[model samples]
Target: MDKTTEEKFVTLLEENQNIVHKICRLYTNNRDQHNDLFQEITIQLWRAFPKFRGDSKFSTWMYRVGLNTAITLYRKSKRTVQTQDFDAVMFRISSEEYDDTVEQQLKLMYSAVKELNDIDKALVFLYLEDKNYSEISETLGITEVNARVKMNRVKKKLKKILNP
Candidate 1:
């Protein structure tokens, strides 16, 4: 990659790193796996950076590439031997205070989400991020109608997990 493209890629990644991190957290059960998936997604983004045509926002492109990496290209065998507690790696309470009830509910929701299949998890991620059906369809390579249907199913499943 040329210096210009490299610089541009770095800038864009810095701004949208949270998207990659969220994907990493959603897909991996442990911290080692999260780090591994994050690294793999970064490498894939860098390699595919040259092909980015700017047709969409950089964040949107990053989402598609990051999801593709996490869902398809990442290998579980590469995870490190060291295991970390899922809560320790997945959730952090900053200095700002939060409600205990809300925190517990959020944890339960995260647990339910983690149990979903890969594609369902991806759909949930996109839906939670407020992506419209069209954007979700484009990101996941599914029809808009399919995206809507899948999202409805995911919501129903989550409701069952939470309420049952």
Candidate 2:
């Protein structure tokens, strides 16, 4: 990449890297896998950067590419275990003051999200990020109506998991 393109990519990526992190966190089971997936997504984004038209918000385009790369690259594995490392430094919560109830609830929610299939997880991720139905449809290449329906179903599934 030229210096100009490199600079642009870095600026855009720095501003929106949280989107990639969220996808990585939702898709990967452990820190190692998350880092690997994050690298892969970054590479894919760089390769596709030149083709990015200015039609949509950069974050929207980032979500589309990041989610696609994650779903394609990370869904081949069939791991059933969900492992999360909740270090105090990572979560900004002091170890001595950690709340067991909050930790347990967080673990339960993460487990429930981990149980969702690849596409549903993407939908949920976008939904949680406050992406609208149209943007979700555009990112996932589904109809806006379908996005709404699928989001409703994902919410119900999450509720069931939490309640059960």
Q: Best candidate per lDDT, number?
A: 2
Against the reference, the lDDT scores of all candidates come to: 0.75, 0.77
Q: In candidate 1, what are the lDDT values of residues 1-164, reduced to their tens digit? A: 67676777777787788888788767766656776677677777877988999998888889999987887743444324222233422222122222234435456777899778878888998888999999899888999999999888999999999899
Q: On a 0 to 100 scale, what is the lDDT of residue 13 in model 2?
A: 84
Tens digits of per-residue lDDT, candidate 2, 1-164, equal: 68787778877887788788778778777767776776677777777999998899999999999988888776555532223332321112111221235435466677899889989999988988999899999999999999999999999999999898
For model 1, the stretches where C-alpha displacement exceeds 4 angstroms are 73-105
Evaluated with TM-score, which candidate comes out highest?
A: 2
Please provide TM-scores, in order, for all candidate models, with all chains considered together: 0.80, 0.81
TM-score of 1: 0.80
Q: In candidate 1, which residue pairs get closer than 3 Å at backbone N, Cα or C atoms, i.e. clash?
A: none
**How many clashes would you count in candidate 1?**
0
RMSD of each: 7.2, 7.6
Error of 2 at 114 (Å): 1.1
